[model samples]
Target: MNLISKLILGGLITASLHANAMIIRHDVSDGKYIQQAADYPAIFPLKDDGKTKNCVGTLLTPQWAITAAHCTILLEPDSQLEIAGNKAKVHSIHLPPEYGYMKAIKNEQGKIIDIEDKVKDASFDIALLRLSHPLKGVQTFPLLEQKVNVNQTIEVMGWGDFGNGLEGVSRKERVNDRQLRVAHNKIDAINGNYLIFNFDAPDSKNALPLEGINGPGDSGSPALIKLPNGYFVAGISSGGDYPGVQTHKREGKYGWQEYYININAMTAWIAETMALSITKN
Candidate 1:
């Protein structure tokens, strides 16, 4: 269980480091309303083998979609983007110049000693996908440039396994069939290139009606905020952890924090990459 394995095989594992959770709320009874259908068509799933959707992506352009770099490892030649029940072929996958695995420095006996930090110790986890053809009629979202303030509310949408905070995201609560869900959370903090959201208990004053955080199979989904003009993507789903909780419990529990790759901080790289990708296409 090194960093490489976590990032490479995370999507297939229940609690891998790179596996982003589905939206889990404090109110389990609201599951019916929290589930969505055909909403946020711009956010779609990335199939791992042309069959199973292990990660999700956002439609930045008709011809371009963005996702986590770690997901690229599981994508196959026949991997397709499932959008509104239609599929688009992936022409190419592009990683940022900074994209690379974080390896732990080991001792002579292979016990880990030190770790390397890059891009502020966060994985440059973003990636871009070039589609073989432009997606017709689907709406696209713009990346947020202005800094998002702490305590501002944002929406998270994706297709994955979900459950209530009381039982967490494991066991029978995790559905085999992925469903589209949207949840809201306020920005707890901003750490380097990541946006942090904590899953507040239903009784907590900070909890929203559908308060939730990311969970398994939500990797690469977008944390969005709507402005007067339209919706803007502020962060990409990355990973989460339960701070100071020693239960070693499954993810998506109450008090757990979800980390999203801050899209605002990576707008420069995203814009540059999209421009270059379009030219190549």
Candidate 2:
């Protein structure tokens, strides 16, 4: 089966086997900014054929979407890029040569064999999706002019897989925690081209808290910075591991999330790309 089907099936299998279940029901506000984000959040479904694989994106510009390099591999050049406020036909996909990697092989004798070819890096796990047309949504979030200081609180939002499905079977009835959950943590040391968040969960037994969050569907959700004027798109939620009772590193350590591709780190790249687009047009 395809990737999305596999994911759905896996969720089902896990739910059937595990008796302890967790459900996510987050409160989403109808306030101005929250409404805007809820209505036009940058996140988009990455589709292959007719299946929804995963969500990956950022609203860098009204006409441009930023996402990881790995996500681009599944995309066709002409795939439709849809957001809350607008839809655009992808005109082009640009990826850096060093963004992707491959593994080496071994012979039956256990000797080292040929190594796979190096794929593109997705430009430091980053990419730009140029839309065939512009969007008419509210002004795009600002770009960080300087590198965001470590420990600055940032907001993240997404509609991803949450809780065991045994609690509810209807897909549309699943919880929508669209509220912008805020997490305050220092920057764990950067890894290659990604930024990491030191998300400390509570010491209590209940592992699933509404505010203390991160999960499967949150990948590629924008890490936003609230500035004097407004919020700026700062980083992308990559992935993280939650230590269960058996896997807890310490008695009190909570789950941690590591973000990849600091938008500020790619400020020059963003400026140059937009400038070039503007100039060319």
Candidate 3:
């Protein structure tokens, strides 16, 4: 199966873990921007029960957050966004028109049945969430409007799930009290709206000090880039790619390809969406 198909199947075909994505080959303490809770308050978790994180999102404004479109299933009226010990209710969601092309088949229980063949447009795997109220006192992230080059280093932050690339993502590491972790990886390729990265082995020459990739439970997490001025939201954690390796598979081991929805390509759509929200209120 293709990498995108495998990723969609892993989440839809398999049971929902409702956990956060973990960073392989890195510990929480080693994170430069995510070591403390207050460091990057803009990053938060999207939850249905006001606790269990279904996906991660980055704050664009006090009332706006950006995440993957597939995560919209969890953003019910009662869904909550937890950030820095504060919880905000999700008011509404917005998606690109092309997202309609990527349909998901669900069973009677509202559980996703199959999306392997239905995911037609991976390029539009992006979404914006409007919160009921403004997240006062919290800083928001700026969208990356500039083009990103391949091999550019980016900072990835997410919540929950923990393990090294060697063992892959361990179910034992999935925790309820999700811990936020950060790691670094360089973009290996760019495909349409996606920025791709290969999780290099620890000893690999191209490996960063905290080289890692997103594992299950981290969908919608932000891939941040530190520009000369400040930090920018460069991409969103969309899925993973494992071509031929049969053993480790999508366990987030070395050689896994991480696909992030490029944010620079959708800045215009994001601006227009946020403007619509302003017009509504």
Candidate 4:
């Protein structure tokens, strides 16, 4: 796990409670994203080798995709993700330009000693990936026009981890890692730069009692808000405060306090980047 808000659920394979953990699909979305349940071919699963790393992305257009800035920074930049079983090469990676990759200091054992303690820029994690080839027939989502409000119910999704001790163990036998899952989260805070929410269950009596949470393998996943138009991308998974089983297991906070890069705040950058002729996947 690259400790600066573990991107949760990317292909970094097994993360140490601090990196890309997937959505904890209790009722499912921290545990699911924009569309509830695993809807194939729409929300493309960005995957690598089953052993290495993976991230989810939304196709804004056949030629472009939206994901976290950390996707380019944390994971291998030269590596390609499998989309629809075809190679989606990164032609260009566009961060805010002001943002730089802030890496965690790890120990000799490769465990993250601390999180992103020195990063000053909050507008650092959202990014756009210009694809090598255009995807066809996949539905693209719009960005939420207004800022999300506190207490708003948002649908979240990821292809990250699930099951056991909050560990990045596999659900569905871990064989279907690319299987997209669903879960829900509520907006708890709205700062100008970030959107935050917790994964603890809103109702204890509800079925799927497992609190919906996000963890390794889910980096770059989208947080969606439904409006009259349709489901819109509101936030991109960025850094987060996670209590790995070694520490937070007994803390009673089942869901991590996930802080996502506010997509609405960066729409200008996204639009500007998309229009640019730059390419790098």
Mind giving the per-residue lDDT tens digits that candidate 1 earns over 21-135? 4555544555643556556778777754333356778887787888877656546445666776667888887777666643445579854354443322335678888887887
Over 1-281, each residue of candidate 4 has an lDDT whose tens digit, in order, gives: 34443333222323422223444543443322433333434455455445434556776677777887655544434546556545667766667866655454567986545444333464567778777778665567767778678877776665534442234343223423444556666777887678877766545443243335455556677888877867888888765655353333221135557778787788888877776665321
Best by lDDT: 3
Whole-model lDDT values for every prediction:
0.69, 0.50, 0.75, 0.58
TM-score of each: 0.81, 0.62, 0.84, 0.70
Q: Candidate 3 vs candidate 4: which has greater TM-score?
A: 3
RMSD of 4: 6.2
Alpha-carbon lDDT of model 2: 0.50
| Per-candidate RMSD, Å | 6.1, 9.6, 3.5, 6.2
lDDT of 2 by residue, 150-225 (tens): 6666665544233321132223333343343333344555655666664443333332233333344444556677
lDDT for each residue of candidate 3 in 1-281, tens digit (9 for 90 to 100)? 35564565567445333666665663324344246647788887776444655677888877888888877666666576686666888888888987653455678997666653445576788999888898778888878878899989998877665666776775445544566678889999998888989989877899987788777878888888997887889999888856565444337777888889988788888898899878988
Q: If the candidates were sorted by their lDDT against the true structure, best first, what order would they fall in? A: 3, 1, 4, 2
Pairs in steric clash, model 1: 20-215, 21-214, 21-215, 21-216, 22-215
- Evaluated with TM-score, which candidate comes out highest? 3
Could you tell which candidate, 2 or 4, scores higher by TM-score?
A: 4
Residue 28 of model 4, lDDT score: 42
Scored against the true structure, residue 175 in model 1 reaches a CA lDDT of: 60
The residue ranges of model 1 lying beyond 4 angstroms of the native Cα positions read 1-23, 26-28, 48-52, 101-121, 171-173, 245-247
Better of 1 and 3 by TM-score: 3
